[model samples]
Target: MKDSFVAEDLMDLALANLAWFDGEDAGDDSGLGCNRDYRDLRGKTWADVRRVLECERRLVADFRAGEWVPDEPGDGPEVEDLELGVASVVTALSALGCIPFTSCNGRAFGGEHDADALIVGFYARPKHWRKLVDLGRGSRTELQVWDGALWLQARTTEDMLRWAERAVERAGPSASHPSLM
Candidate 1:
């Protein structure tokens, strides 16, 4: 039988995976220093949004490219550790501004997925969960802003990618925020 997992359990597992990243040490004040908010249908400034998206892109690229392989010589965690690592990767990606709505479906309460796993990995507190959920809500065109909540529609992946790219462009750094790195 499959082990039933609660949202909180998944969140805890995800957070544990990101423990090495020191997201808590980032000192980002917007609920999720790295986690973003996407409630306004009009969207946020590009500069602010790109930093988060860049983080997402890097994480996804790493995962898809198989660059996160555990160290050899039995230094890696066991099977359970691998599971948690996957969960953490998912959480971190979501926290850094990718969408995971495809995975949650109706399991979420009030059509809201538990983004606590993602948010906690990016920020220091749990309250940022709402912002992460809002970001996911805005990622899809199928989901519309009606009345004051998200409504489902026939959206496509291209639309979401376009939106994410636009958000990144707007959020990308300007001449003012020079990168020391």
Candidate 2:
């Protein structure tokens, strides 16, 4: 369950996340010192992203090569939750300039094939839940945003996006301003 996004845009999206973090700390306008932290960390952040991407490529290649040792301790959903799916989604969303406050695509503790939910903390508009339901996407995409931030538990990426399109639209343009995170 991944969303399409431009890798080059990740830096800006990261800045957006940092800015949101700033908003949480200083009740003094997010615009004040938002970009400062980002400017200083850009190079390091870029390098980190590159390193992770390279390692991910290697991991995938190893798996494809049938060299994935099943004897590894955490080679199950619990680890996948951290090492793959969640990381991938986080990165994808970051590229879109929408940072999740916190999230979890639930996993059965030991690869029991019982993984059964997805959680996302996003920013959305009022009455957006109704719109999602009307779109028929809410049946699988649960939404709650009563207190300025949207929290969701979508069953599928498709379902998530169906509601997100409307939510983002209602929030207005500027991808960096897309989240309350």
Candidate 3:
């Protein structure tokens, strides 16, 4: 809902993600230990991905146009389905084709290991994994590869959302950036 930049960038990223959906295999060995095999993304057809992307695009467009409303259920993973305070971050990651698998807005009063912190897990190519590593430097974000996927953790929901908003703003040229996937 910030501006057209985020929407346009998201649309561009969606296109890029679709283009690279089942295309050439991105070489691994970037030292990030990311799983380029994408076993977690198995069973997802092109149509499924497209539906999600299209839904995201429409939602972004609506938000950009100042339309304040919640996404209807059963219409694919809409922004409303995401945990509060982490929707922006998750959407940005999804737009970038990171293939988000899990996320938590974190609970300060909950009995969980991630209490008072934000967490997001996604699958990415080596190049995208490198971008995340570079972005996390000197920041509160923590990057880890576990269970053949990449995870990002931040101290608070605010920090996580801020980091992800930055990513959305910078994802304009990332559709084909040499340093990004």
**Highest lDDT against the true fold, candidate:** 3
Tell me how candidate 1 scores on lDDT: 0.30
Candidate whose TM-score is highest? 3
46-65 in candidate 2: lDDT tens per residue? 22333344454455456557
Off by over 4 Å in 3: 1-79, 108-116, 173-181
The best-first sequence of candidates by lDDT reads: 3, 2, 1
Give the lowest summed-lDDT range of ten residues in model 1: 101-110
Better of 1 and 2 by TM-score: 2
- Position 127, candidate 1: lDDT: 34
Return the clash pairs for model 3, or none. Answer: none
RMSD to the hidden true structure, all candidates:
14.8, 12.1, 11.9
In order of listing, the candidates' clash counts read 6, 0, 0
Global lDDT scores for all candidate models = 0.30, 0.38, 0.49
Rank by TM-score (best first): 3, 2, 1
Instruction: Write model 1 residue lDDT over 138-167, tens digit each, in one string.
Output: 343232222222222212322333334533
Q: What's model 1's lDDT at 143?
A: 25
TM-score (all chains, Cα) for each model: 0.29, 0.35, 0.49
Better of 2 and 3 by TM-score: 3
